[model samples]
Target chain A: MSAALAVEGLTVGYAGAPVLDGLALAVAPGEVVALLGANGAGKTTLLRALSGLTAPRAGRVLLDGADLSDLSVEDRARRGLAQVPEGRSVVTELTVDENLHLGALWCHPGRAARRVAVARTYDLFEPLARRRSSLGHQLSGGERQMLALGRALLARPRVLLLDEPSLGLAPRVVSQLMGVLRATARETGLTVLLAEQNVTSALSIADRGVVLSLGAVVVDAPAAELADDPALRHAYLGF
Target chain B: MDRLVFLLATGLARGLVVALFALSLVIVWRAARLVNFAQAAVATVAVFAAFAVTGATGSFWAGLAAALLTGAAVNAAVERGLVRRVPQGSPLPGMIVAIGLVMVLQSALGIAFGPRHRPMAAPFDERPFVVGGVPLLSPYDLFVLTVALALVGLLAWLFNGTTLGLQLRASAAAPEVSRLLGVRVPRMVTLGWALSGAVAALAALLLVPTELGLNAHSADLLFVHAFTVAVLGGLDSPTGALIGGVLVGVLVSLVTGYLGAGVAPLAVLALLTLVLLVRPAGIFAAAQVRAA
Candidate 1:
């Protein structure tokens, strides 16, 4: 099977210092890959680079065999690459309904189709339906995360890059989010690259885990294997 | 009593024009996060286009269309050619560049059209309609009111009811996030500039006939007054611009009528200061400041 998303010799830097140096990885279709790392392990940078937010110093990001180096962020998104960026990604001024509608702006051309997609998202995330008219800032952390996920899913993306979705949430909420992610990936056959700090929860849903340290991958193994290895977890994941 | 009524009526008409222009500023600010200092000069350039077209075609309507199109095209060109090139890490550089643009545009207009004020005749009759034994809005004033209100309503609909508006609002509020969601944010920003330019041109087109006619500097005062209105309304609020425009308009009219023409600017300045002191964000500012 071909890789749904692939990165080759990816090197992203700010000013002079590289954040993601000589990184290479691949995720097959319908696979969930947890990107585990410590605080400065370049997990966020890799996601940003993949999503076309951060320009890679030297590398190729292939989305379904197409080179994404020249594409702008919106163009990349239109090609079914979506990113749920770290921290409060929602437009705080917009309502939950508007935010979801925005997600379907390019993909769903017909107004009726857009409305149906939004309604479907609301059904999938019941909390969002209850607060359809509420502003983005009005939602709780868990609700905000759900809204972010719902918004991204509305894009019907081929590959989803999520940055720290479980941040600032309770453990139960994190698990619930993980379960939804796992179910969604399985049901939709959606490829995912999840950048996370929460090791145990992330490993729970991930088919494989790729650990990074100082801009390079340190461990690339099965999720269960990484989860069970205490020394590996302590050495890299900081759990 | 009759004088007060006339002043109030005239003030309302002028206020609507100011509101329309201020709303233009609000639009550009929301979309690009930059206060376009050259808006007045850009509008003046459109007015010049309208002037030339009206003079050539002998039709005010043709001129009106010319103004709207020229304004939109020029503003879009400026955004694409100049404003987009500047460092966007802060608002100050864009503003300074805009200020420079203002100087260049005004100087260019002065050279092209000369310093003389060329009279652009109003499409409608200037004679006021008498109602209840009192003189009220002239046909021209009524015309201004109709156009301004119609444009405002159209813009309000565009921003609140349409898909493009949603994308624009999303682009304005969170540009990076909007981009990731598949919104062509740069295009939205350019569209914003185009829309603002058209509106500003229309406002200037309406106001010039009532003032000392068209000149290179015709929109300078209008820009000042409209800027005050935008700040008074809160840079981000369209409703604020509408209300603030009328309030400032009435205050200016009353001050000019009772005090002197010179005192009008001072009154606007004072009103702006008071609004700033009382509510730094403007009267209708959003409850939460968007994270930059």
Candidate 2:
């Protein structure tokens, strides 16, 4: 009934030290929200909290207005919230096709519909489609990223969370893949929340951009304005 | 020629038992990514349990089922309590645990059943028949062969068809990613151990009846054979383990018949050593298994 995602006053850490303190953001259906922050900025932690991978001591994450604090990681995924987890999320031993199929494993009863979603995932990442027989260990980094994306999309999530899609990729490959992601968002009407170190590229596709310095939200504005804001860009993004 | 046929048939059946045990290793390797030095120990425990239960109840099927369940339950508890807590823990730790299990299980059996060998009930009552005057074995071979084949088929279907199976594969391949995806990595890991125990029990149930009695020495020998088969085939490839088991079984039988009876286990170990020298990754190693 409400937005696809809403995080209010989130605070999380592994030990006692807080990494993400009072962080907040929300995105409606079909919206693209870019979370831009430097290293150690708790962007990854915030994403983890939202997907129910980590328990936050404070604040709430609402997925379609449902509080996801108590849901297990699998339960959150089952509720149509999927994350393209960092650093080789694709099961390296499984073939590309198997990884894609497992993405829909989160789809419990609507599994048949999720199969259609898997087919769409293959269609979305044609390189993965071609090398369907390859395992994650056998894939190139770009192919691995595409495979990771395909795996997440199979869940048919309303909100697709990507952690640094552009990381370790060539500029051309990153731009090309980013375009595909943006197109998928427009065509599928799926809201996307991506945390990126690539400021210029993220702003190119995002409707709105949120900047974080340390753990708190420092800037939330129109993507174009944030991109052009010299003061914010120089101070936080190093762009 | 008749003598040769007799030896081959006997050896082949023996090999089938080894192959099934090797299959247990394969299941463990696929799920836990550990070679499970304790597989033989688990199998030995199950065999003893089966003998005790079958002797008391006088029903083979009931006893066998109980043994397999015990194996699963024991392995599940161990994985959840002892093994699963250590993430990406080395295979060495598992091997150590397995070695420790050998002592504990052996001591427990010794206390309960005594150090002396105990006679076990044979699953089949059929005697070997002379078919076409050539000493064809009792078709008990047929039953064992069929069960092992069915288990293989079931595993293939489970890995290929079921969602839980996919999660299991994913968890083994990438624990961190699987965690992020919301899979209880520990739960899948526990399931892996349960699988290892179940398969080990099944293998032991099929195997123990072929011999005169159940003893720790015999169980330890079975582990050596299964381990050789697992290593020879490629730790990750279940099919390879099966082939390796059969090959070792037949080879050992032939050598014992012609050369010497005492050197068969050594021969199998030599063969596995050769395999390792050639391809340390294993003949049928999966990508992740090879990478590791």
Best by lDDT: 1
lDDT by residue (tens digit), candidate 1, A1-239: 77999999999986467898899999999999999999999999999899888888899999999999999999999999989999879889999999999898888889999999999998888888999999999999999999999999998999999999999999888987888899999999999999998888888899999999999998999999999999998898776
The per-prediction i-RMS, to one decimal, reads: 1.1, 3.2
The TM-score obtained by model 2 is: 0.88
Candidate 2: residue A196 lDDT (0-100):
96
> Chain A structural similarity (TM-score) per candidate?
0.97, 0.93
Tens digits of lDDT, candidate 2, A75-143 = 787788888877667677888877777766655346676667777777777777788888778888899
lDDT of 1 by residue, B46-84 (tens): 999999999999999999999999999999999999999
Pairs that collide in candidate 1 are none
Q: Candidate 2's residue-wise lDDT over B1-292, tens digit each?
A: 8878877887777787788788877777767877777677777777777777887888998888888888898888777776665555567777677678778877887887787777775666547778888885676776777788888788778776788888887777677677656577778888888987988888887777776578865567777888888888877777888888888888888888878888877787788788889987777665443322
Could you give the TM-score of chain B for each candidate, in order?
0.98, 0.91
Two-chain DockQ for each candidate model = 0.81, 0.50
What fraction of the correct interface contacts does each predicted structure contain? 0.83, 0.62
User: Which candidate gets the maximum DockQ versus the true structure?
Assistant: 1
